[model samples]
Target chain A: MLEQFGNFLVHGLVTGSMYAAVALGLTLTYGILGILNFAHGEMLMVGAYIAFVLTSRLGVNFLVAAVISMLAVGLLGWVIERTTFRFARHEHLNGLVISLGLVAILQNIALAIWGADPLSIPPPLPRTLEVWGIRIGEQRLLAFGLTVGLIILFSLFLKRTRLGKGIRATAQNAHVAATLGIRTERVVAVTFSLAAALAGLVGALIATIYTITPFMGGLPAMKGFVVMILGGLGSVGGSILAGFLVGVVESFGGGMISSIFKDGFGFVALILILIFRPWGLFGQRPEREDV
Target chain B: MARRSWQALPLVGLLAAGVLYPRLLPGDYFLHLGIVVSLYIILTSSLNLIMGITGQFAIAHAAFYGVGAYGSILLVTRLGVPYWWAWAAGILLAGIAALIIGASTLHLKGAYLAICTFAFSELFRLLLDNWISLTNGANGIIIRFVPPPIGIPGLFRFDLGSRRSYYYLMFTFALVTVWFVRRLARSDLGRVLGAIRQDETLALTAGFDTRRYKLLAFTVGSMYAGLAGATYAPYLSYIAPDLFDVNETIYIMMIMMIGGIRSIWGPVWGSILLVSLPQALDITPLLRMIAYGLVLILVMIRMPDGLAGFLDRLVSRLRPGGTWFGEKA
Candidate 1:
């Protein structure tokens, strides 16, 4: 039991990092746009499929495939933003409908292109590392290490750079940011592309850990939503923390209880938090518009 | 006075059509489809009372429906309670559950309320799936025997055994539900809910208890769903957790949106079109699901106001400020 507990924690951190990496984009979009991108999961699914195609068809290394996938998904996000989400009519409900429609379209496209069967991505490194009686797979360690490095880089980018500050400023108050000479549109566009890139990276990594399937994004997207709400809708820091927290809870909980309950935990936590806090763990009361 | 009578004519005609249509339609399959549509019409309209009218999104609507179904099914099968009493018991239990959930969560507005309600539905589903000793753990309890006779007692036994009778029963119930909502909409409570939906802070300043009204709408809407479920359990004769899923909630919202939200008969018209469309297609299962997804997306993108609202506007255009059924008295 002690050894398994140790194992659960190790596994949790790896899985949790991937979750945080992708869900961070969800946090940014929700904070700035206030629209739950229901297709966010499908974006990840697209990325994974891209990686699968790159490696299997082109015989590229997994890392190179991931980079290619990220660029492709980033381009897709740019296109989606310009075409679908750019229109400002009843944004929230309209975004929901459009994103949902996109989910179906993407899933069907994937089905047409790759079929419904699952595909696997071979690990970039074939070796495993053992330290202090802990067995760690090389691919998982690389994912974990990459995620931590990215988080640090992202934090630095957000804090130090002018573009990063502009994005943050827009998230805080788009009108004020625009008035202060920061182009809110550019900031929003950049944030959205960055988010898509992060989702693509996580998608590629996840494909290495698990099989790449068209339907894979649905569960993860729903779980990420639960995590985002729990951590507070727009708080990147909170999302990072809560992502790991959810992973640990799910890992240990699944190990203890049934696996079906794992998916239920994020939502359960969300409801409990909303009941008690309503503002979320780190969220502020959004200025009211209508009801 | 003549114009007012004209407005009444459509309502009267619709009720008359609803009553007579079952007899006019041939084949049991279409009748069965009619029953499902009517059931959804009730469900979607009841959901509209909370989401559309009150502006409080309650995705847990189906959870209340499931509670009603499970509550009555358990009472009838396990406790040996008669069907009539069991049905009432299920509705009451569901109503109470809704009341509690509403009181706790309805204070939240916007997406927060939606998230909370969604969580409750998920919780209910988990409990239903896990609680093996009671729900038989996904196997589902099959209701075997007919309850003791009701209505005409010995001579006119309530035979749930047949589909045709069930169809008429569901259609009549749906009509009564529409009438009830019509009355509610015209009431002062409806006005208050509308005000709250428009502006809660302003409504509070206007001396309206926005919280109370929101909760009231939630509970009442859920009660109607529960009642629908109570009757529905006997129709389906089986209860499962999937009936109360998030997708079902989304489907209800889509129907209401398509039907021209805030319109009284919008859900009924929308349900008739959307529900019957795929069944009429009669395609393979995988292609059918794909088709369903496409249909929903196309409707959302191109026809947001839905079929009924479009027709209503078209008729108005041709007639020039005239009513479809007749002019208001």
Candidate 2:
């Protein structure tokens, strides 16, 4: 019983950290832009596809392919913002519609380009390792490490950078930040691009762990959306906390109940949060009652 | 009353066209297409009630559609309930479901509400897919017969055995929904919803509990979608989870957006064009999705206000005294 429980804990952390990676970008974009980009998952899908193309088709190193995929997706996000989303800054629903459109377009584009075949990163890590009855795998450890490192790096970037400060300020008040000579548009664009890059990185990291299909992004993207809502939209801390919490629930739910029920937990959590505190676990209380 | 009669002319004409066009049409396929067009028009227009008039975005509109479909289908199938009562049950269940969701999440504004609705809809879709005992786990429950119309003993029995007849039935429902929404649009509630859309803070300060009004809008809008779905179940005789996915929700939103949200007839026109266009294309399903995506982007960029807005501009151009576009523009 002890050994099994210990195994669940380690596995949960591995999966949880990866979820945090995918969800981090969603939280940032929600914070900075105040619009949930429905296409964020497609960014992950795009990244995974790019990685697949580089490794399988072009035969690039896995690490290099992952980096390239991130940068490429980041550029795609910047272009999307510059052309379509720039006009929809203040109009919340317009942004949602545009992003939702982008989701359809991106998914279809992926389908057209890559077809529906599920791809995977070339196997590099040893399958598994047992340490005192707690089985650990090299791939799981690598994914967990990459997610942790990325999260830490992201925290530092947000904490100790001028651009990060601008992003934070814009999130707090775009108009006020603009009044203070902050380049709000540039900040918005940069933050969006950075968020896209983070999602892409997470996608590549998890590509090996899960089947990489063109439409695989939809489920995880929805889950990430649910996580963002459950943790409180735009709350970074809430996203991380909820990510791990969700992972644990999923781990236990999958173990105790069924895999399908594991996915249902996110929706259940969301409904409970919506019923009790719609603002989320760590989100700021709205000043206005109308919202 | 004289003014109201004149105001209803276009509606009368639409209903007349719906009834007569099947006779003039060349094929059953077009009639089938017309039925789909009218079904979507109902769905989109109802969605517009909240998104356009009340300025609330809901990604779970199709969930209510599914609920109504499933409710009526299950009632008619399992309990051998009468067709009309099954339809009524579906609508009621949809309204209740909407009320529950609205109560929980309507207070959250903008994106939060949108996300919550999206999540809930997805949850429902999952349940529909996984709840094998009840939903048959995605093989979908089938009905033996179409729900016959609820009416008198002999005078006006409805014929739903044919797709053309079903087209007329859905077309009637679509027209009624449009008329109801138009009435609401021009009424006090409509004015308040419009006011709330323009400035919620000001509306709130002006002694309006915007939340209550928004919830009412959400519930009413959901009820219309439910009615659409209830009608749809018997028409199609089958519904998988695929019918009520986020894609369908977005498709309805796109129809409303392209039609001109806040415009009474926008959704009707938008859905007609959108649903008809794909059928007219005669292409593979894969390319159809790609085309749908491209059309959404192109329509938004070219006609931001949608087909209704475009037509309104054209009408304004034709009439010298009318400056609806000018004032709004």
Candidate 3:
């Protein structure tokens, strides 16, 4: 029984890391731009598709494909910010609606290109590791490790880099950031690209573990949003913690209670959290004006 | 008196057109399309009440719709209840659901409210898909029994089994919905909703029970969706969990956005255009959806007010006084 528990725990952590990676991107974009990009999940889908095409079709190395996917999706994010979101930044609701339109566009474009069939790349590390009589897949371990390393590197980037400071400033107060000689537009673009890149990398990582489909991004995106809200929308630390918590909850719930309703657990948690603590675990109560 | 008579003329003409639509087409396919259009009209108009007029962004309209459909279907199929009673019960179930969801989540504004509603929708869909014994799992419920005809004693029996009769039934329901929504939009409640949408805090300061009003709008809006779904289940004869997902809600929203959210007739025009466009164009569903996305993005950027607003502008421009129906540009 304890060994079974360990397996579930390991499984939860691995899935949790992916959720955290996706949530990091979502939180960043929401923080800086103040618009919930409904199409954010589609970016993950696109990233996975790009990597899939490069590695499987063109015979590129998985690592090279992942990097290319990240950069390409990041560029797509920049263009999206400039073209669609830039015009909608002033109207919060309009921005959200525009993102919905983008979701339809991107999802359908993907469906057109890659049919509805689920696809997956050959796992770069297919070996299984046994530690203390507990078995773990190497690919899952690699995914978890890469996610943690990327998150740490990202945190350092935010803390140590000048552009990262600009992003922070812009997220705090765009008007003030602009007045302080920081180019707020540039900061917004870069933050959006970086967030998209994170989503892209996570997508590639997920592709290694799970089959890729046009609609694969929808649920994960919703879970990412759940994690973001659970962690307090703008708090990076909150998202990372909440991501794992949600993952474990979902994992244990599916394992013990009912696997069919596994996806429903996160939504249940989201609703309960919203009802009890609208502000989230680590988030400060937003100012009245912020709503 | 002259102006009042003149205003009534267009409404009368539109009513005549709707009543004669099936006869004029005389094709089963067109009648089928008519039924679908009417259903969407109900959906889009109700959604407009909440999202467009009240300015609350709830995307779970389809879940409420599903509730009505599934509730009524289950009753008719399982408990052997009469269709009309089951239908009313379904609408009530949807209203109750809205009451619960709205009371809990209405306090949140903007994206928070939107996401909460979305989560609720997903939860509802999950339940419908997983509750195997109750909802028949993912295989969906295929409705076999035909609804009995309704009439007063010996006056007139309107059979609902026929396609033409069902078409009229749905059309009449759609008409009632449109009329009720129009009345509500013009009533004192409508103005209050508009005020709340403009500024909830200001509405609170102005002595309006904003929360109560919002709850009322949401409940009523969702109930309209329920009505549509209840009527729709019998016509389609098959109901599935996947039929009422987030994408359907988004489609309803798209219709509202394209039609003109603030106007009563906007949904009418939007639903007609969107429902018929692909049919007329004969484009593949994939390309059609892509076009819809492109149009939605373009509309948001270029014409936020939607096609109805665009037409209103054009009419005002063409008129010498630069006003359409006495509403100022």
Candidate 4:
């Protein structure tokens, strides 16, 4: 029983870090842009597929391919922003709808290219470490370690760097940021890019743990959005915490109950949390709560 | 009176087209496509009332639809209930579910309400999947024949045992749904709902029961969706979670947006165009979804009011001060 408990904890944290990585991006984008990217998961899917192609077709090193995937998807995000979301910056409804459109388009394109089958690459480290009789995969450890490191680096970038501060300032008040000579458009675009990059990075890492598929991003995307809300839309720390919470809930709930309840359980917890705390665990009251 | 008759001229044309569609094509495939279009029109027009006219972005319409389809199908297969009675029961269950979901979540604001309803929808889908004893899990339930028991033995038993019969039934329901929505749009209730949709605070300030109206719109809209689903079960003869999942919900939203959300004819036009586009162009499934996404994004960005709205403007511009085909005043 104790061994199983430890195993579940280990699995949950690894899962939680993946959620956190994407949720961090989602929250940052929402904080700055006031729009949730419904197609964030497709970005993850695209990222994973890119990494897969780079490694298999071009024989790029796995880690190097992951990095390239991150950068490529981030650049793709910038293009998407300019084409689809620049005009829709102020229209939250349009942003949501457009994001969904992007999801459909991306998913269909991926399906066409890859077909509806799951694919996987051999793990970079293919070793398992047994700590106190609880076995953990090296791939999972590497993925979690990278996710945490990047998240910390991201937080610092948002705090200490000039561009990062510009982003936070814009997020705080776009009107004031614009008045203070900060190009809010650049901030929004950069944040969206970073978010997409983070999603891609997580996607590449997650592919190490599970098989990759064109449709794999949908569940994680839903969970990541739920985590964003659970942690509070704009709170980075809250999102991280909530990501773990979701992972733990899903892991333990699926272990104890039926596997089908994994996603369902996470949403149930979200609904309960919402009922009691509409603002979310870490979210501040949005200025316009009427809608 | 003559002016009023002229006002409904466009709708008359629409009615003629709808009635003549099966006759014009007459092939089984075309008739099947017509049934699918009719089903979508019934589904999305109700969605229009909740999201378009009432301004509530509830995404749980598909869940209610699932309830209707599953409920009616279960009653027929499990308990030997007649098809007509099962449909009523299914619609009632969906309405009740809507009432509960709407009452609890209606007071929340836009995105919050949307997510909350989404949660509800997801939860229902989950239950439908897990409750295998009742829902048959993800395998889904299949009803080979509709078994249209007229309830009166001697009143002439109409056998809905073929695709053609199912098509006619769906066509009739589609017409009824369109007619009902048109009447609702012109009624005081629709006007009040529209006002509330415009600004709930202002609507309430003007001494309106905003919550009641919103709930009414939600319940009625859900019932309409339920009716569509219940009718759809025997038409497809197969019911599964995929048919009523989040994807389906969003697809319904897409139809409403593409067809034009604010008008009754929007769903019909949207459904017809979208359902037939792949067939017409021989587009691959992947290419079709990509096109759908493009159209939806373009419409939302350039013409938030939709294709129906575009046509309404064109007609009004063509005939200034005239209610061409009963454009909403």
In model 2, what is the error at residue B91, expressed in angstroms?
1.0
Q: If ranked by DockQ, best first, what sequence of candidates would result?
A: 3, 4, 2, 1
**lDDT tens digits, residue span B1-329, model 4:** 99789756666776788778878989988888988988998998889889888889888889999999999999999998987899899999999999998987887666666777888898988988899999898999878765564424875343577677777677778888887888898899989999998888888888998999999999999999999888888878899987898778888987877777777778887898879876776677788889878876888788666677777777889887654432541
lDDT of 4 by residue, A1-291 (tens): 998889888888999999988889888877887776788998899999998898887989999999999999999889888788877775665677788889989988988999889988779899999998789999999999999899999989988999999988898899999999999988888989999999998888888778888788888877887888888766888899999998888888888887877778888888888877777788887576443
Q: What C-alpha lDDT values do all the predictions have? A: 0.78, 0.81, 0.86, 0.84
Winning candidate number (DockQ):
3
Encode model 3's per-residue lDDT on B54-76: one tens digit a residue: 99988899999999999999998
**Second chain only: TM-score per model?**
0.92, 0.93, 0.94, 0.92
Instruction: State the local distance difference test value for candidate 4.
Output: 0.84
TM-score of chain A of each: 0.93, 0.94, 0.95, 0.95
Off by over 4 Å in 1: A1-5, A88-90, A125-130, A133-135, A155-163, A172-190, A256-260, A286-291, B1-7, B143-158, B281-295, B319-329
User: Model 2 misses residue A213 by how many Å?
Assistant: 1.6
Off by over 4 Å in 4: A31-34, A286-291, B2-4, B149-159, B320-329
lDDT of 2 by residue, B148-233 (tens): 65446885555888776677777888888888888888889899999988899899999999888988999999998999988888
| DockQ of prediction 1 | 0.40
lDDT of 1 at B184: 82
Candidate 3 local lDDT, residue B324? 37
